[model samples]
Target: MKRFFLLVLCIFATSCTGGGSCAGKKEVAALPDTFIWNLYSDPKSIDPGLVQENSGSDVGVQLFEGLTEYHPETNEPVPALATSSDVSSDGLLYTFHLRQDAKWSNGDPVTAHDFEYSWKRALDPKTGSYYASYFYIIKGGQEFNEGKNTDGNSVMVKALDDVTLQVTLKHPAHYFPQMIAYPAYRPVHRKTVETFGDKWTHPEHIVSNGPYKLVSWEVQKEMVAEKNPYYWDAQNVRINRIRFLLIEERETALKKHLEGSAHYTDDIPTLKIPTLKSNPHYHDAIQLATYYYSINTKKKPFDDVRVRQALAMSIEREKITNVLQQGYPTRNLVPPGIPGYTTAKGLSFNPEKARQLLSEAGFQDPKTLKVTLSYNTNENHKLIAEMVQNMWKENLGVEAELYNQEWKSHLKNVEEGNYEVGRFTWIGDYVDPLTFLEITTTASTQNYSKWSNPVYDDLVLVQSGKERDPKKRFELLQQAEEMMLEQAPLIPLYHYGRPLLLDPRVKGFYGNLQDMHPVKFAWFEEEK
Candidate 1:
């Protein structure tokens, strides 16, 4: 029966391709060991320490290996560069045993020292790593990054030997192994970075320790990564090469997939969702991510809690999500289905209360209040921005100017606090509420809104990490999220339902909660 079904599927696929021409058969027979991915946008930076965007990490994962990596099927963190690890009785100290077989793309040995140097570089103040706070779990890491301590030696990550690394955390964290899988913790070739400086990431200079090594990069067009011969698990890597295409338009990406030019694409036009739902290649699943608008709290008018709340309460999130046919409307930043954590309900659409709040915030004549709404250049984002603009105008008589910028520029403007309110999305780095909650803290570089509350910070940054009791820790996190929602520094819009197109020939690709599909395990099935 399964064979019969596959036969039918093949027939259907052929019929859809150029009116069942022999050309389609030839194309299928000639499928290469390369995985062509529509990355959708040009990655801002592929440097492990510097990558904060999803697109960059998608590419970074291909070219780097950390102590751990996400399991292809489960999204669970498993040992990668490290063969195994031992935890001390206190659970504060972790000792990782490096895999001796691990080697960089250039055939250099990957050692514990590489991990130590890469981690320290991330924490170095001069690196300007936006994700520096993620390493705060390590003792003295926060102090070093914040410039409170001048000694890098004080930070408790130490290479005990060429093959063993010792890390002492300020607090006990059971999920430390999982957290290390994040791109920020990946090791870079120390010598290559030192010699080339910022140019170390160029294909000619880069020495990576993952399944793939970047061979060519044409800015704004495509990046190609060939298999790394020296990678520790090279024997298991199926995909020999990966072509990351920078196709910004969703329509173009879908067209490329349909035309057999690309095997995988991260986006499809929202309007096409209804028709594409019937296609076998179409995949739509709720990811552990949230889309929201980051209000620059440091800016005037937005600084007022009432004003921020008014803006948050005014948006009809359901209408936007319904119209788009993607994502579940959400007021809470963290999506549901996390183990042992209950999502906190946030302020819903109440335009009457929003108007009252606006008046209370001293904007009696709402026309006097004008703000700019910024988003990256994408049709979906523009549509959402337009909906939001109209909602603000109609609900509270506030005028919102839509400011669109390309991906890189949008990231820069948000990072530098150059925009009033910016569209943003946060996908969980690990399977934890801390991944989303930590972004609201003052120390977080992801906190584009620049919203800070001491009480909220302590709960998430300090208390939650130290609490060994899962129940108590979750409660602390929930409280923090609730408090953050009341302040409304950012307006939560929806939990992401990522719609992707994957060619039938592609195998070993699973849609995990993180939406992260490591290409090392993916391969094209041989044509029958």
Candidate 2:
């Protein structure tokens, strides 16, 4: 494992020399003027209604505004784009009062109609929006999404006036306020999206109502966003400009940070952890992200619960954590530090118990069991997958093959059910443990495992429908977590610690356990 970590660092250092074109530049202490961070892929869209993942959402947070926002430290819901909000006693109807000062990047007032159009567009079957299900609580939203109902008569979302909007829900949800804080639920200017079509995010077509506006975007190179002078809070935006540079190689990012081309970077090689911890400028901590392997329950081998349990038991989670992960080990899908996570009954690593279960289930010979474990090319994912492959071959007497795919294609495979066992991860989109643990529910689109448990589904459904009592609702969610652990449809790997290298001169740029990056308060001073 130590050798593997060293190998990664060595590859990174090697790539900085002859492989990449920037190899010739001299290194320095900090970036010159511009603030840059590293991203593996360019943002898919600046339009909030269309963003489905963190890559898009992270950028969307900078480019769009939602009716509500989470208080940076407490995760409490507060008004952002909306001035005030109210919920009916039944909890099915929500009304939001828009802030009069809200305006689009192009200087048009952002009204209740913008929210109405955005919600309708997302719920319309023609949009093919994956995040549309988030609005299912809204009246007729599910029917509209399924084409059972038309847009005109749907009562899920509507504008009562220029600044007041109403949202009717099929059922009440306690987390609905938190849900609104996510970019996928943010409001968008319909005319802008319609006018730009597919090129809506292609720089020239970009419009933002947040603190920053898209000023320039160079594919696979750099994306530059300048402060929106027209934003309601423009005077309070501490950073004048932000540049997101797409640097896939950790070594290249490190080199750029060292050379003063980037102020902060995401991937800090594990070997550098000790030194990074020692430095005052470097802030390294376990981010809320959890890494796990999803077994395609729809496929062979994995369809057998014994095989899944055997595979889960063969690998040593502690070994992987101590050896490969710079962060902490995760016992289940629900990450620690979240509101509802309990470690008392988490997944136990017992090889003997696992083997007994496997043998009882009739898996004995290595020849009888054949499976494929797939992962993306991230050094961490590959390293862990290799460790699991070796563990399975040694302990279970099973023949296992490893498959590596590019990140995008790998995500496609997992989403399309193209593999028997595949790697997957989730960082909380909000503070709730339900966001991570509930992704496996039969109704969840992100449920790549295709795992279905009627009891588990009922627990979640009932809670989302009637459990208004926060304490009782959480108890029901705990029951759902227990059921998932019992099924073992997914292997709970380690929770990730996000390690970032930052310049000493930069301030107010940091992230919390939820991976929330708020650059609004960040500012730069000349390096001494």
Candidate that scores best on TM-score? 1
Candidate 1: pairs in clash:
none
- Compose the digit string of candidate 1's lDDT tens values, residues 391-411: 999999999999999887898
Candidate 2 least-lDDT 10 residues = 4-13
Question: Over all chains combined, what TM-score does candidate 2 have?
Answer: 0.89
lDDT to native, each model: 0.86, 0.72
Cα TM-score per model: 0.94, 0.89
Q: Compared with the true structure, what per-residue lDDT tens digits does model 2 show for residues 25-78?
A: 664323334577776566655566667666677778888878876554444556
In candidate 1, how many Å is residue 146 off?
0.9
Candidate 2 lDDT (Cα, 0 to 1): 0.72
